[model samples]
Structures are given as structure tokens and as C-alpha cells.
Target: MSFSQFGDKFTQHSGISRLMEDMGEGLRTSGTIMLGGGNPAQIPAMNDYFNQLLMQMHQDGQLSEALCNYDGPRGKALLLDALAKMLREELGWPLTAQNIALTNGSQSAFFYLFNLFAGRRADGSKKRVLFPLAPEYLGYADAGLEEDLFVSAKPNIELLPEGQFKYHVDFDHLPLNDDVGLICVSRPTNPTGNVITDDELLQLDALAQQHGVPLLIDNAYGVPFPGIIFSEARPLWNPNTILCMSLSKLGLPGARCGIIVADESTITAIGNMNGIISLAPGSIGPAIANEMIVRGDLLRLSQEVIKPFYQAKVSETIAILRRYLPEDRCLIHKPEGAIFLWLWFRDLPISTETLYQRLKARGVLMVPGHFFFPGLEHEWPHTHQCMRMNYVPDAEKIERAVQILAEELEAAFKN
Candidate 1:
């Protein structure tokens, strides 16, 4: 039976699910030391907090009622207020409950924002969404496709061969048109783990304002990085700037709580769209998050407990890579904050795909670069020389994986 035509945008796109499924199948069959996926290995404070919450809810007779009730789409008011204050104090983005909308996670916020601003034109022309060529996250493209939005990647931000992995946005080369709906940038970028500078953010803000387009900043990995702080809430340079954040990378994915902060007008529009899409997130989710924020324990824990732990692990992983991989053979980005390293192979004989299969055969798994740019084979340079490896796995697993990767690289070069 033929499936009905999905919207044309979706027809041309391969969603994250397909990439994940393929990776999962490889992992199941090959049993390689898995390093490809960005799943965090750190335990979140919320795990213990949730247990305490369960006891309290049970005693208060609120557990069953919460499970049965349909929460309002705007989210729990208390949580929204707390999130706004947290943004003000933590990231310095001036916002309020009116500027915030709670969602299942940052991914939900991403989809909601895309649906709100990325609808089809009456003339059937596709709207455009811009992102960095070497974007750290894959969600931007995935969300854009579902809305039938065209994705345009800028050239890899030029950086010295031996300098930090950070790239600068060359605003001149970007596709700027009335049809461009949004520009998505991740602070403390995903794979490279470098934070976009404030100057860069200001420039992005200006461009978005100039073009009457929205700038979406994904701050999923902002907190743990040094020299990066959101200390005040200034209005986004453009009225169109939309900020999406998550507690997932902050050690709370199961809480399934995230916040979207935009101007009042944008927030109202998002709330309306959210109502149509997801009625409301679980009430308990927000309530628990609210308590975490209000008590200030969450921030303290992130600063004192979680950040240091992950930072040490990241440092150790980088050192291992430096020790094991020859400098001339593999280029490793020194990540400032976040759990990943973007490894670019130099003079490697095998394609990244072949390397991935070989590493998997040896019980080590890593994400090949192709999965990150599924549909743009024509635009990108053809070099299967890159992969994203997460260092947040178990210490023993990380050591084993790196050893296996080093061995594979040597073998590939020999062949």
C-alpha cells in the first residue's frame, strides 16, 4: 500500500529516528564500545530528588490526582516563574513567566518554535533556516525538515589548524532573504564543545534584526564551560530572538523539563502553538523542577558537584586522546565545556563510514559525520574524515573505546 504524500519538506528529509535506528542496529550487532551517541553518563541530582518527591506526594495525597489530571498548556505557573528568575540570575537573560513556556525538553521547544515561524508560504516556496556548517547539534536540521523548512549551512567557520576548535560566523556569506525564518546557533556547540562568544551573539542578533528573522540560541551545554556566564537579562538584540534551554545536559533529562524565553509576543504565539501540539507537560515534572530551582540547591549542585565531576572526566579523555592518537594523524578539538570531541582524521586511508564499521567490529561505536548532515551531500565537501565522540561514558569504557579507536586508526592507515 502506498503511503499518502507527507508534506513535500518531510518527503525530502530523513529524520533523526532513521539515523538513530541504524546506529542502534550497528551497536546491537557489532557490540562495539559505543562512543557515537551523546547520551550523558553522569547521574543527575534529580534522580535522588524524585525519590523524595514521590514520598512527599504520596503522603500529601497528590500523587494520584497529579497522575490523573490534564495540566494546562502554558505549564505550571510556579515553575515558569522560577525558570524566569533562574534565567535572570543564571544566564542573565531578562525574562519573566510571561516570556517563558515549559516544554517536554529543548527538542520540544525547538519544534514548537519552528512550527510557529516556519510555516509554508501561500506561493508554495520553501522557507529557509540557517545553521553553522559544522553545527554541534543535529536537532536543528531534524526540526526544520518536519516543518518543510529549507536548511542552509554556512561555510565551516575558519580557524587556525592548531588553535581552538571554535569557528566564527561570516555573516556576509549567509543566506539572508525575506524567506529566511530563523538562524539556530548552539552556545558551547555540541560536537566541538566550544562556546560561541558574546561578540558573535551580538553580531547574530544584529543580522536577525536586520533581516526581520528570528535567532534561536540553543544553550544546552552552557553551564559547565568556563569563561561563559549569562549574568543579566538584556532584551534580545532583535525582537525575534528565541532562546531554547534544557536541564538535560545540566544533569536532568528525565525531569523532561526545558524553557523557552522570547519576547512577550513570541511567547504568546508559542503558547498557542504548544496548546495545539502538546496539551501540557506532566504537572509533576514542572513541580519538581520548580522546587529544585526555588531552593537554589540545583544551581549549587551544578556548580559544586556536577560540573567539576564532568570537567575532570572531559580532561582525562582529552589527555588520553593526545597520548594515544598521533598528533599528525588525528585532530582533536579542545572542548571548553560539554561532553564531546570532534575528531578530524588527517591522511587516513579509510572513509569515516568504513572506520566506523571497523571500530564497531572491534566493539567501539562512534557517530560518523554523515548522520549529522543527512540530506546535504551535494553542498558539503566529500571527506569522510570526521566523527563525534562523547567522553561522558564510564571511565573504563572510555579507556577501552579510545584504545580500540587508536588501533583502528593504525590499522586503517596500514591498509
Candidate 2:
């Protein structure tokens, strides 16, 4: 008649819940501009390629049967093989189908992963997910089955020239305690679009290795696919690392396919979990994406099409923001990759939540900075004065939103 703690926590109204609901609604009031969602940009060329993939499948009469069948929890064998080959040949990672597993999406994969490494351990010891960066991903904040499942290090703010800044891992403050079950991070970070560099990753990997915990790389927006990353950071892989990838950024969010690359033992356990929980990963994404993997079109398209599509937008948005926002009062993080720009409003009169509301009433939507800093019960005041602006919208609309943001933030600062 009541509910378990998991049920209660999952049902609790939170910022992430609001974000998910907004993403699903997929529409704004007729005049309102919504810029909070993380949906991939709709590139016409990529759309054509996707349409072509389905059209060919339909012509070959492969669509109906694929839809009617269960692919098992491990996902399509052919896709796994394609991914395995790509990882081995391109990235030089020693891998095979045995090292790969599939899930509904990166979200479901993390739900499995966080609980897999963390959660209640034997002897009543509670393991935790260690995030070297505090403002990692809001979605992961509530992912673990245990309420106190995460430990995070507050980052050192590295302000750059031209009103830009970055969040560097404060390794000095990173807690490498024995209870840390895993090290997790998202390259091309979701809210801030900060790509954790190779040097930074190596240090974190070394820390994880020393602690005997696996390094979990959430590559939902990183290497070997979609390749939306604009940083010089290389796509990384190692036997001790867990690489989680998704097809969502490849313009196939509806297909709900996520691939996990790890050691065979972990892959086997994940496969079992997938079977018991989901019965099988959806067949649609693997069936279509496998061809792109085999033919090398996915990589080519990402390099030539996808990367530039978002990169241009990032450049455009930076120009717009730099023009409107006061140079000293506003700070924008370098849009290293991903479709969002992170802006910090220094010493504003009101919190970002209140700023979000004001902008919402003015027909603009943005994610407040407060929602991004999870697991850190205490934080710098700057944490509450930032906003993540999804730049995937039209240039005109995004510029409009930026103008509104600058005006509102400037007015707030004066007051």
C-alpha cells in the first residue's frame, strides 16, 4: 500500500524530473523559445543519411522482421562485432563482442553501471561513485540505488582570457578513499560542455587504478561515434576503463541504443542484468548503426558533418553572447564540444533559479546552474549564478534568447 525508498526517491519532484518532462513535451508555447533541452541538433544531411538507412532497409524488406523479433539482452550480434572491430583497429583497444554489451540508452546503462559498482557492499559497507568534477551530470545525481552514493571534488575555476573559463579537477581535494567503487565522468560534459582533457583523464585513471576501481567514461557525446567533441582531447580506452556510448547524438534518440565497452567479465554481468531487466536491447539502432560502423560512414559523417554543424553554432553563439553580455560581469565557458554553452553571471542580485523564472516569463528557457552541482552539499557562490544554454536552437532564436539573458542578468547585477 505504500512504497519502498527507491520508489519514493524516484518519484520525488526534482530539477531532473522537470528537465525530463520538458524534453518529452517537445514543444513550447507558441511564442516561447525553449533552450534547456539536450536534444541533438537536427542536421539536414544527417537526417537524409538516417532516412536513407531506413529506406534501404525497407526496400530490402528487413524492417518488419527486425521489429517483430527479440534481439536478446546483449543486443544485435552484428553490431557488436562491428563495434569491436572499430575499437580494435582504430583506437587500438583490444576488444571483441565479449567485451561489449547494450542497453536502452546511456541513461539506462548508467542506472545499471552506478548500481553495479556502487550500492550496498557485503559486510554492510556502502560503496560510492567518485566524481572528480562536482558539476558532472544532474541525471547521475539520483542514479544510484543508495541515497548517499556519490562523493565529488569541487573544481578549481580556471578563468581564461576573452571572458571564458574552465573547471579543472582539483586532484588535491579528490578523495581516493577505499569506499570509492568507481570513477565516473562525462567527456564533452553535458551542462558545461567541458571536455575532460587526456592528461586529466590519465591522472583520474591512475587514481582509479590505485584504488582498484574501474574508470567509467560516459561517452554519450564522445569518441568512436557521433564525434561531436571539438577539443583536442583524444578518444580514450583501456582495459581498466568502462566506456559507455550512445546513438542518441547520431540523430537516433528514439532508437534507444547504448553500447558498453569493458572487460569480458563485466560485459557478461551487464548482459545478464540486461536480460533480467530489459529482456533485450532494442534492435532498431544496432541494425541501422551497424552498417555505418562497418562502412566507416559514421566516423566520416561525424567528422565532416556533425562536428562542424555544432561547432559553427558554438562559434555563432559565442559571438552573439560576447556582443550583448557585459565583458567583465559575464563569463562563458569555452564551448569545447556538445550543443550547450555554460555562462556564469558574477555577483548577480538573484539566484539562477530566479533568473530562470524571469527568463521563462520573457519567453526564454534555460537550465539554472543550481541543478548541475550535485553531491556537493556545500559549494562556491558562483555555482548558483550560472546557466547552461542549449545552443541547438535556430541561430536567430538563440541570439534572441542570449540578448534576453544578458539584459535580465545585467539588470539583476545592477540591482
Candidate 3:
């Protein structure tokens, strides 16, 4: 059994693949406490809205039209127009329908964008994607088709009061050189949930502009839509900036729709790739989202419902960690906006990868931190000392999971 370079590279045991596999396996196994992966919490209000929307769509014939018709490579027209109008009117972004394009999902959008900008080039010189911050999304680790497609700068860890820490982009030492092709960072970042400050974002934007490269923001958990951010963050996009959003966080992961707002040229490029690939992004998510925007319900739901749910979850989860885990030995990343809480065990005897296996044996699941630091060059012990835990599970499950986690940490330190 032989495979091509693409097949071999993708088939390799990758971090994203392992995270997804564990999530699926945990789903199948009973009594599993699922605190791993990036799955959004299923909020009842959101679910009810979706159910009603589906029913209405069915009644209005929108459901059948979306199912049976094939949209252009860019995506369904109504959704694009709705998004463009919403963002333009609300945020005053210089956007039109031409600026937007849809992909099968953000994962595929990233695969297309990363490979488009980074990797081998025409003139024999290769380019790499620069993650100004190291502890980025694990899914991005394998998105590139070529090996060594990324380079990252170590973050400045700010130890805050009350046993919490935050990761700040080390802007002074960020390696934005000629060889770097694109700049990217996730807001309310995936594993850590640290939202880079507005100042930091402006700095990155300035750097990207200076370097003549486009800035790609993975806003899956950021402003105006999912509205998961706990701290202050202004939505930013320009001709040079590519903002990627998703309906997945808005309680439609199965819909498989990803929205990209960029310059017309970039949108066209994405649309061309879409034609070559999935032929067009799925219409279900777009169909639902279009109505949400036009009816002026998206922002209201995000702000009044989804935001508060995650905020309460963060506060409760932090309190549980404080009560169960050793105060002196554990430090949490300041929960900003995302569903995940990052925990760093001080001087643990074993790496988080080993701890993950022990927790799995007890029917608890979490993502080890090492996977998050994809393009980091040096060996940093801090990476292994950390783990990402999601608060999407029920209250009883969360409490039980924390208890088991505390016990395992105590045992590991003793060993």
C-alpha cells in the first residue's frame, strides 16, 4: 500500500486528528467525561431557535431549495449579502458581498488559505506562515501540505493575581521577516482562551502591513456573532485583513459552513479553490444565518443568551478548580471568552501527555498542551506542564471531572 506525499502527510498521526479521534471515541464509550476537543456547548435557547428556524424554513420552501440547488463557488448569495450589510452597517467595515466567501468549514478554509499563502513558491524561494504567538490552535499544526510550513515566536506569560496567568504576544521579539508569507492568530485563542488586546492586534496589523503580508484572524470564538469573548475586543477587518467566522459556535457545527471576509481578490481566490474542491460550501448554515441577520436576531441571541451562558460557565469552572486543585501547584490561564480553560501544573513530575492517559483511564478527557505550540522552535517545559479543559459538560460531570483531575495531579506530584 503506497501513497502520495499528500496522503502520507495527512495520514500521519497529527494533533488535530488525535483530538477528534478521542472526542469520537469518548462519545461512543459510556460514562465518559468529555472535556476535550473544541465542541461548543449545546444551549437550549440556541437549539430551540434552530429547531424553529428549520421548521420555518421547511414551511417557506427555503429548506428544499437549499437542499436541492447548487450555489455558486463563492456561496449562497443571500447569506453573503446579509453578512456584508450587517457588518458594513454595524461596524462600518468597508465590505460588500464581493468581500465574502464561504468554505465547507473553517478547517477547510484554513487548509486553503494556509496552503495558498505559505509553502513552496514560484521563484524557488519558499515561504512560511508566521504565528506571532506560539500557543495557537492545534488544528493548524497539520493544515499545511509541506513540512516546516510554520514558524512562531514564544509568548510572554503574564502571571496575574488569584492564581491566573495570561499569554501576551511577545511583539518585541516577533520574527516577521521577508520569508514569512502570512500572519495568523486566533482570538480568545483555542486552548488558552486568551484574547489578545486591541493594542496587540493593532501592532500585529501594523506589522503585517509593513511586511506586505495579509493578516488572517481566526475569529471562530470572537466578536459580533458567537460573541464568546469576555474581555474588550473591537472587530477589525480591512482590505489587507482576512477575518474568518463560523456558524459552528453559534450552535450549527453539523451545518459545516465557514465564512471568510476578505478583499475581493482574496475572496475570488477562495471561490476558485472552492470550485476545485467542495464545489461550494454547505447551504444549511448559510440559510439559517441569513434569516438570523436579516431579522436582526443574530446579535441579540449572541449577546443576550450565548455570551452570558459561557461567562457563567467560566466563573463556575474556575471556582471548581480553586476548590479541588492544589492552589500552590496549579495556575489557570485567565479565562477570557472561549469555552476552554488552560491549566498549568507547576513542576509536575510528568508531562501532560502522560497525565492525559491517566485521566482517560478514569473516563475523563482533556487535550494535552504540547499540541497547541506548533511552530515553537525551542524546547519549553511549560508546554508539557499545561493542558486544555473545556467546560461544555454538565455541572455534575464537571465537578466529578475536576475531582478526578485534582486526584491525578496529586498522585503525579507525589510520584
Winning candidate number (lDDT): 3
lDDT (tens digit, per residue) of candidate 1 on 67-99: 677767777888788877776776667677898
Which candidate's TM-score is highest? Answer: 3
lDDT of 2: 0.86
Model 3, residue 363: displacement in angstroms? 0.8
Whole-model lDDT per candidate: 0.68, 0.86, 0.91
**Could you give the C-alpha RMSD of every candidate to the true structure, in order shown?**
3.6, 1.3, 0.8
Candidates' TM-scores? 0.86, 0.97, 0.99
The reply for model 2, stretches above 4 Å from the true place, is: 23-28
Q: TM-score of model 1 relative to the true fold? A: 0.86
Better of 2 and 3 by TM-score: 3
